[model samples]
Target: MAMRVVDAAAAAIAALLGFVLALPFCLAAPSITTHGSDGGGGSYVSAVGDPGMRRDGLHVAWEAWNFCNEVGREAPGMGSPRGADCFDLENGVDENGQPTYKVVHRVTDADNNLRAGDPLPGSPANITDVDLYAAAKELYLGDRCQVPDSPSPWQFWMVMLKNGNLDTTAAICPENGRPARPFSQTSRFPCPGGAGCMNQPLVFHNRTALDATGRRLRGGLFGTYDLDAADLGSKEVSYYSVTWEKDLGSGGWVFHHKLRTAPKYPWLMLYLRSDATKGFSGGYHYDTRGMTKMVPESPNFKVRVTLEVKQGGGPNSQFYLMDMGSCWKNDGRPCDGDTATDVTRYSEMIINPETPSWCTRRRIEECPPWHTFRNGTRVHRTDAARFPYAAYHVYCSPGNARAAEQPTTYCDAYSNPQPQEILQLVPHPVWGEFGYPTAKGQGWIGDPRTWELDVGALSQALYFYQDPGTPPAKRKWSSLDVGTEIYVSKYAEAEWTLSGFDIVVPEDCVGSSQGGPLVPEFLILCDETLILEIPNQRVPISRGEEEQGKVTHTHEGCLEEVAAGEHLVGGRELAEIPDPAPDLGDAVAAGAQHDEHGGGDRLDHDGAAPALGAVDGEQREASERRAEEQHEHQRRLRGQQREEQLDHGCGGESVDPSNRWWARRRRRKWGRRDVGSGGISRRAIWGDGIRSSRSESSRRIHNGRLLEAVLGASSF
Candidate 1:
């Protein structure tokens, strides 16, 4: 009798130990599910630090550019044209116990006022060039507003203002990334004033401040490219402003933008951009910084935003509903900042109703060589009847492309710092699948709506040029923006408001390949209960087996519920298991299924499975059998407990064996009723097998050893 009792105890311990070890692996697995308006199955996460612009504390910056996207010279007393408004909100209770909040600023006015010849923190000494100073100032300001996150840290959103007046006579702008000589100016190049036409704007800052109610925070940066203008309100002078406001703890920050063009600065561009946190952003050669923490790749990301255009700038206003920017060589390799060799690639959807498509049958050069449909069908520009010309505004090839097909319109050589290719789209039925505007006036002036754009799918289908016979470049977008560029128009005004902006990409696209943790540690104790342990919070995940052939778990206030029929366990999907006795082998098979679904099996830094494959085939089989026995034991234990409850009518105290076992262990280990510090302890049984205490020489003992020990003890 004594031997039998000891054997039963040993079996119980082994069963619980196996469950504890398997929980983390199951939860850490990647699952597939549709996200946003893009109907696709994949694990998604926000690519930005402040997803949807919902954070009360805001981080935003501003930059001014010349014709070729560089600052030729700073406006007098306007610093480097790089500025930031970043702050944190402190929540506290007053003496009356009423909530009190204080706004704490990060980047000060002094920081924003630093200019050329002024020493900047973290910048190279003796750097006095106007363009280099602006670039360094942007990096300096980004460091001030940086937010720490997994995978990498992120900075602020960018408000980009550009003066499009290129002084061809002065040779200020480069021609296809090469030095240019003086040439006679013409109507093709808009420079109403001769020299110094591509000068920076005079920037004015209205530092963010709280209102009397203390529940609202507002701030803005406004200026004009007309440096000599005495009055900003004057209609003859160009003006631009981007103001942000948000109600504390409710809704997203609304960015209100206004841009006006004048005769001197007839062609002006203003945009709210989300640039990469590191590396060169589109149209830029220097290392840049902005809100995009995880730069989204093509075919696996989506953009969500709410836009209201109060007034369109003019008929010449090229209003971009969405503009994506990336850089690569014609040979399909990533750009290495070699301006002469690198080519900037841009694709944008122009929502202006009056904007006509230049891609007519007669203008084959304005159209791409080929158009790809959502269904993978291809139609050449020559196929007039089948090609959707109305869907495209124009397609321009890079100037330096050696193998561009015949009848191609090379983009303006002086517009960007490098040779560039541009694909401009218009409202058409072909783009309806991506949730873009399908008609001329769908989201124009009077139509204000929230847009969830399938930018990924559309970008993948769009035509971009590459040298023939070269491998395709990975189309990873480094810059995303929305706004309008008033093309050589005088006294034109554009007003708009943007909110709820976000870029979402598959969670696996983030840190999986980088060997960073996909998510916080989670442990699903039993098949029925899941306890997710994030830093400083414990969220319960309830299992729902209501629908047949489907298993769902809803995480309260933590994450979106798994889609129907998707057996997601700990952020990963599991293969369907038999009802009566689900074997541990199914979990192992699920790991393989995850690799087939989308993202490959989770890997450690050195690209190896930490614990899943550690158990040999024979050991895995034994573990599966022991897991089945444990399931049977739990079922019997629950049945006996229910019977006792019915017989004695016991209400208060629980009789579940697992509960009693945990309770006894809790008291013995810590002399307390609760778990240690509300988080998993180092000594606790977790993923990657049991992690030993810090003092132990061996950091981890594999699950194979654990199974061997459990089986050996059970044999007694």
Candidate 2:
């Protein structure tokens, strides 16, 4: 007889960390249901504002950058290179009792068009430095899209674009965050004739709008690094565009992204990131806003994603199927943004079949000291027979380590605000145990499948550097994303679509039986459809049923209620997660609105402010009328009530085995509901398989030290 698991070791760990454990169907009704993780009679409560991307209202933002991730200069007429598309969906029954809806946009074109050094309309003054201005603008947009929730409010999914050409002579980027001396050009990095090569891109946005039938919502952002080009239609220029669309009530939003590389601009990066709602994320130094309100720690959280890659950028493209990032100090403590002391850590699974492993038998330095197996066995790099060298593409140590291991490759010193450590992986059989791609071309073009990755389990087994004899650092990840980094791929284009992305964490972090915070809750997600099917043979039958040639009828399967925290000895494997998009190009010749020298004509600033006097009365009248028309249109778009039934996207579906087993005991029903903002129960599980607790704060106490104390001293 198959033992129906209501209590599993993994599920209990996930429950304490806010993972949704499915209970059996409790009623005889044709309906869907959502369950809360707080141990109350189950009710659905989404951990994110737009659960499963199934909401008509959308919140998404975009940011562009130069070689060192800073706004060295702004493009002409385009403000700080940051923009957002945030809106609400209004629904009502028409005269015929059919649903009618409208898109209400919150951010205006004028607001998104503000350039650096320009004063914000009707707002207090802020720092005018180019880099500082862009950061502030991000915060401003976050305020507009912020959705209040239990742990904290959330903003939007970040679409990040970056150009990777550095003008060595400019010395704009520091070495490990410390000022660097100007150096001559080297073949390792590229530059197109020095001057104006580091300028930002010309960005364009299409506000989210309804289709003719008002049954679909669509919008996009498109532009290029070649500022002088007429538009994306112009030839010989690098370009990028991301379009988002959704059918009314069909499922989840679908993001389609396209990136083209140019000869001059050969290396670029683009990614859709789910960052911490209010804290420093991965490589960034400033506090950022994003979809994850509760960050997930390693060994407790998992991710679910669906990705389809259309065009790989030749052999040089390092397309990340799943990329995760976090920050910490050398002493095994969380990072507090001290550039000199903090180190950014990254792990990426590169799925390109052409990408080869740099860690070979002769290149011990390129490999981590040890390889860990799922069963808790560790093999040294010297143990080539046991060590899975092909499992790793390369491992780079942080540049700031004092006592370094010999022959190790240090990460690029100038790519981020601080020193960094990076681990890149290629597809191999070793990863199969974690639900990752077992071979090449598994999820590449023409072969798309939804993945439910055991990210927590895999990350726990991966090797990371730490100071000798120091306590192990808490593996709390602040940023998780997917996409591609086309390293110097001249004239290549990469395209793809990403949907059904999410991270799942536990509901609470009360002390666990194992003496750590991790507790698992069984979550089984069937691809495409939400229905979870367990075969009857997998369930146990009563003794009397054997004599009658049939089991005591429950439905089709047997129901078993085991004690919580027991191991799920026999069950099918769960699925994994996914990432999105491709790379930016080389820093091609770009246009900077302002003159490089002090004596040239100023593009925007004038000697005197225009007077509000009677001069040019007719012109002033025309301007006023135009402004009034624009205002009227905006008012009409936003005039409706804010609340309505949520139109859910089709993704982020997970089921807990034990929880669903209990659900089967009675008649419970679930209908569509708004993805509202509110405080979560202490036991609120994220949908993506990552573990998180609403009651837990970011300032976690570790080994007699406080993470908050470190945060307080940092620039954030």
Candidate 3:
């Protein structure tokens, strides 16, 4: 038997904050079975008006890390483990009203090659050292790539390159936050041959400028670590490159990433991440610059992304669809500067359906203690009949977990600057509830897609250790990314393109049943995908997962439910919840037309303004009137939606664990129905389904503190 989890700890806080948790009446609403007007409904939040790759100009960079995340032996004269090529496009209006944009390159080679021992033009000599040198290098690059916008400032997207081989004999990385100690190792820690095998690479940057075609703005950075070896086989040596381009002033940026492994650097990894703007990102020990300024917490956010794989690195390339990294103490406290106690936590959805699950009914060590249901029930990992073993790739706990339940797998000690916990999932029926790819090869090489995932809700249900009496750690994620770690696979090369990516924390007030107060979310106020936010200010970060994460595919997995409701109120026959607005559209389908003047008032279409007040003349008055009117309108709509419920043959107020889960598990024997504006429909956040090895597929509900509002059970 598994330990039962009722609602998440965050629910209690949400309720006390004055948010109304509305329960349905005894009578159910009419069954929702209407096909959306666009002919097909889009993701509830994503349908808001997907910006869909609009040109924000090309901004790109690349960085490499050693075992301790430091630039060890900076690749001979390759300078620091940092370099960038960022540019913006300025559109010029032609006399005929045609638009022409020019690429503006801001960073120079002099900026990238500056070493720590050299004099920084504007700085004093005090902050000179290896660590400070890298820090200063980033700051200087930020100066060149910085793009100003309302709300907060931001920088270019980062292309991260990491070499996993660690020479433990060298004592380069710390152990469990303590100083690095001499530890005897074998094949576990990958080493090619020599002692200095752990070194940065020779990085080259092609500053952003118009490509020869002259029609598109393009730039890229490519490099290799086989410093002195020129006769390297495509797979015998290591190489990586990321070239970005966009039609001047037109589509969104397209970042094409290519990573290859060699005999020496077989465990190389690469990812595009949205990190914190001014705080620590995943696996990072210092304050950094990034795309996501505002970090996102679990169960309350959704991610929209598009991925197309050009080449699948060999079987060992563990690609991630969405890898979210965060930090906190084992005691459930916000992580501060203490590298020793602070743990780097990650939850990755691996898409390589071929990846085997290290977890199984007999392998409890590879799984979390219990799985939460959509109806808020819990299934212990021991529930052989119920637990979905294949969904999990692996589960590793933090090294610092004091009382980690007996059956647990501790994470790798050398892979991070601090102890870390990882939860890896793969694409399976168990995740179908979250709108993820259900079968293998659904979105691999030839099948590209735009995915809307309920990351917030699913993460809430996943288990993270907390001290006995400590308030559960607020799962405030700092990094959300998509990339690959080609674990020691020689000659493995993976190529993919990602664009139109976003993570949204709906604008709903903390808890109240209020609406229309939040500004529709955008790709970035900082003009980059990585966002580092100052808690509630919505600022994007550089290490950027908290607010912005990359969208990727593993060579692995996925991320969630609800509906037209009916009820019999006062015993009167109801058709549907009269005008009851679905608590959907948590910032999906955002676009350039969403009112840059105030960052409020989105305009998906002409009709969207009726639901969201306009930002034109008489804006204040119109907004006030609209607010009051909407309140009254929703009151009636709720009644109608309620009455409609009575007409539908579904109603049972006491809550049914099987029929619907609290956060996920909504089903329809019929087809789909429209839920939000702009062809949006009700979609699940994070959900799971269980299919016994080629057996019957049964949907298991996972309910956690993922969503801030009530989407009800019956979700994925």
Model 2: residues with Cα > 4 Å off, grouped in runs: 1-47, 93-98, 120-124, 231-235, 508-716
Q: Where is model 1 more than 4 Å wrong at Cα?
A: 1-43, 512-716
Runs of candidate 3 with Cα error greater than 4 angstroms are 1-53, 92-100, 126-128, 231-233, 509-716
Cα lDDT tens digits for candidate 3, 107-147: 77787887768776677774456766787777778777776
Candidate structures ordered by TM-score, highest first: 1, 2, 3
Per-candidate clashes come to 3, 84, 129
- Candidate 1 vs candidate 3: the TM-score winner is 1
Worst 10 residues of 3 by lDDT: 552-561
All candidates: TM-score: 0.68, 0.66, 0.66
Ranking by lDDT: 1, 2, 3
Error of 2 at 360 (Å): 0.5
lDDT of 2 by residue, 212-280 (tens): 988888999998888777656543689999999998778899889888878778888888888877667
Q: What TM-score would candidate 3 get against the native?
A: 0.66
Q: Which of 1 and 3 is the better model by lDDT?
A: 1
* Winning candidate number (TM-score): 1
Error of 2 at 680 (Å): 30
